[model samples]
Target: METKKTDKILLFKGIKLLIFAALSLFMGPTLMTMALSDKENSLYIPLLIVACLICAMAVFLIFKGIKIIMSSMFDKK
Candidate 1:
């Protein structure tokens, strides 16, 4: 792969990682707040769980992307 394409992939991966981190931070608190509130909502718990799972997946993807970029740096000409 060309260096430019590789760089773009790296940049995209980094952005995804940042997005996931933000979602994790936001969702955790939002869910907690909703659970504590008196109002009952059926969807909140499931959505919260999904959000947590997505956060975990995002972290995994970030690491994978880093590894790919590093390996690409060492690719034989």
Candidate 2:
């Protein structure tokens, strides 16, 4: 029973990492474009800041996920 729960937890973590990676991959580029567009708008600065933050966060999450997955894989052996 405990082993089953552990397997489920690991599966959930793997899925979460995958989801984060996908979101980061997709949002990072789109946000970069939006941030660089030259349009006179009131929300430009705020949006750009937000985009920067999201990009940073996405990067962090991706690295973290990769590290976790790699460690888990090696641990299996």
Per-model TM against the reference: 0.51, 0.68
lDDT of prediction 1:
0.62
Where does model 1 exceed 4 Å of error?
1-39
Q: Which ten residues in a row are the worst by lDDT in model 2?
A: 1-10
For candidate 1, lDDT tens digit of each residue in 1-77? 45533455555666666566666667666665665563367776776677567657656765766665665455543
Question: What's model 2's overall lDDT?
Answer: 0.70
lDDT for 19 in candidate 1 is 67
| Candidate number achieving the greatest lDDT relative to the actual structure | 2
Q: Give the Å error, residue 40, model 1.
A: 2.3
So what's the TM-score on candidate 1? 0.51
